[model samples]
Target: MKRKLCVAPSFNCDDDMEELNVAALSSRKESVAPLTAERDGTLFRHSLSYPLALVLRLRVLQIVCGISTLVMGSVAFIEERQKFNMGLGIPAGGFSILAAAVSIHTSRGWSLVTGGASVGAGAAGVLWIASGCLLIALIVQSCRTILDPSGLDNGDGEAIEDYRPSPRDLIVIACVQIVLAASTLFSAVVCARIDCTA
Candidate 1:
């Protein structure tokens, strides 16, 4: 009788290894998906065109602030005029509105002129810094008024959403002002650092 020899086929080992490799690759991809998504989200939030985005945001907020300030100033003026009283409140508020308007116009004009290049970036950055400082002042002022409920007397100098001024409006405005001020500050920093040459 001839001796029987049993030889294991090499294909079985290859198939097992291929299966394991495929499974490992799949597992790796699945495991990395959430992390990849999280990283992408973070980059998307932080990697925005800092200066441009800041400018745009500031433009919109400035418009809103200008309009609000104008309204408030007008109301204050009418009330004061009716009472035969003259004060700096109206003028100061009006000046704030004017400053915001000028900032908006300056930014728009500069963007149009320089196309966000190095030509006027320095001047623009300075202007942005100034505007941001002004915004910070406004934010501080708003905070003082919002934090102290008693700070608003007759709600004359305060903003209101309804017939009677409510603290809710002030709180909301304060929150928005804080956000705007922070964004302005961040924008100023970014503008200051921008190379503008590339």
Candidate 2:
């Protein structure tokens, strides 16, 4: 009877060891899960300092510039009677806004995504460059019309009216527009080059 009791105790110890092994394995699995999630970029959020962090500070600057450009472009278009102002303002500003939003959304922890944000950024860069070119042309034309009204006159005695923005105002508007376009262009270049694997 004593031998039987000792043998039963030994069998119980084996069961205890097996349970401990299973518990250890489960604990290991639990620990590994979070690491995998973090590796997949789903577990943690990144700050603005990282080049491709989830919240890019540069995008905020871009949004501000975009809004200013949009407003300026609209005002110039209406006040200057320049169709090119609206053309430059609306699309370029809207594109900058849209691309920044997408970049903010698609960038993950310490990295950017594969397709959407990058492509949008590249397209935005091109649009900004285009806007800059258009602004340059508008400035040249306004300057020519202001400096030598007779050069563009067609014998109708069409005069540079008081309603048209003055040379100073035109220069201010064009300069602001060009600066915003250039800034947005720089931001786009930064965004487009963000590394996905980092």
Best-fitting candidate, measured by TM-score?
2
| Model 1 lowest lDDT segment of ten | 80-89
List TM-scores for all candidates, in order: 0.37, 0.51
In model 2, the Cα lDDT at residue 171 comes to 59
TM-score of 1: 0.37
| Candidate 1 residue-wise lDDT, 1-198, digit = tens | 999999977678788999999999999999999887776422333443335556556555555554554454344334333321112223333444454445544553344444553344455445455555555566676567467533435557763333334446555545554564455455445433442421
Q: What is the Cα-based TM-score of model 2?
A: 0.51
For residues 139-192, could you state the per-residue lDDT of candidate 2 as single tens digits? 454455445433324578675564445546655666677677777767666665
Q: For candidate 1, list the clashing residue pairs, or say none.
A: none
Pull out the clashing pairs in model 2.
Answer: none
lDDT of each candidate versus the true structure: 0.50, 0.61
